[model samples]
Target: MEEKRQTALVTGASSGIGRETAIKLAGKGFQVIAAARRMERLEELARQVQGILPRRVDLSDIEDREKFCQYLSDLPEPVSVLVNNAGYSIRGAIEDVSLNDAKRLFEVNLFGLIRVTQACLPGMRALRFGTIVNISSMAGKFAFPMSGVYAASKYAVEAVSDALRIEVRPFGIRVVAIRPGFIATEFNDVGNEMTGDLLARTDPDYKPVYQASGAGVGKMFVNATVPGPELIADIILEAVMSDAPKTAYSAGFMSKVFLEQRATLDDDAFDRFLTETTGLTDLKV
Candidate 1:
């Protein structure tokens, strides 16, 4: 018997994990709609995917929420999957980051993600089938010094994915949280935009410790990084098709270890580990 084709909507499809996931899904016979602000990149992606529809929609904008929802609602076949993959890191302490930057991070990472899920819910419920894959990060589990805002946003995403999984299971909808470790991407570079001057500033006395710690993280990414985009995309494809997919998935080498460590931590041990790893001593902020 010929099977019906499923449709997936992937946000942040112009680049990185979202782009790769979209391609993988399309290759696996799912009709894909690749949404991102970069229309030229998306156009290129559309060419690459077997049967992908490319659309330019910035997930960060609150105003476009309704329009995007309406577009998906009117799709020929109901959207069977949604990859909430558009997000960027804002590197700074909470107090050092601007309110606008914080808002922008959450607008895409949390608010916009939730908005799209809410918008897609009716259709999913009506059809009695769907999967929601949220692209969280390792920082979602462990708070790095400069990534407070970004970590908070991803933490929110992790929480939402956890709760929504149970809430929608009765309606035949599944939510999967994908926590990726540091894969080389534009996120590393673009993190500067959100941090502004704050990234360069740490406690005057703790500068050396912070510098060394940052270097360690950079070295880890450079040394142990996995293939970007396609590797993550293949995982997403598996998550969508597997009847018994794990509620949460942590991809990449360091990501799995970091998340495991975070989950299994005693407060004292975690504190000690953090202090040692970051080269911190008994210093108060």
Candidate 2:
């Protein structure tokens, strides 16, 4: 008899890393549930990839989340892999960013991720087999200016994944954190728009620091040989296929280097390093 195909659910599947991951998983013979807020885009993805179930889900909405969970519960096959890839960045100074905006970011990035994992845990535990892959960032390891809130959300993911890895191991569930650095995606565009809005209203005194940070970001993307989201998707594929996957996997250009530097440097030294490299100290805030 033919074996049952494993099902993998990938959030933020409209584009970028999530979309690539969905396609890759489907190629690997997993039934891929591709979910995002944009139904049309999901539909397009479904057309492109065989064995993909396009789902419209907005993680920030409580009602939508509940509905999605219900749908998952009713799936014919057990969800063997849960890829928490739905998240965005909000770029601004902490003081300049609105409280509501920050809260919304947390809603999607941190709380939403947790809720989805919670929904999947029962079934995973019951089956005694599963893998949870959380898409974190290099920023989670070490934060810089202009994207502190985004970093914080990823840091929360890191913390939660560490704890969850330990908690779920006994039940045969593997939790892995995939941290990607400077992937070419629409994320940068969204971040720039948020930063632009903040710059429009920010105090002139803080504008220089903000501009410097912006320039640093632009330079990183332009000069660095940033890989596309396909590389990350490949890493996720490996994690899914591995019987004993590592707790955390860092990928992309300079991701390991930066993470190593973060681990090696003291607080003061790290601060000074960031300041010098990003030119944040050239213009005092």
Top candidate on TM-score is 2
The CA lDDT at 12 in model 1 is 90
lDDT of each: 0.81, 0.89
Q: Which candidate is the best by lDDT?
A: 2
RMSD of each: 2.2, 1.4
Residue-by-residue lDDT tens digits, candidate 1, 205-229: 5556556667755665564546576
In model 1, how many backbone clashes occur?
1
lDDT of 2 by residue, 58-113 (tens): 88888988999888888777788999999999887888878888888898999999
Worst 10 residues of 1 by lDDT: 276-285
Alpha-carbon deviation at 93 in model 1, angstroms: 1.7
- Tell me model 1's lDDT, rounded to 2 decimals: 0.81
Q: Please give the lDDT score at residue 241 for candidate 1.
A: 91
The clash numbers for all candidates, in the given order, read: 1, 0
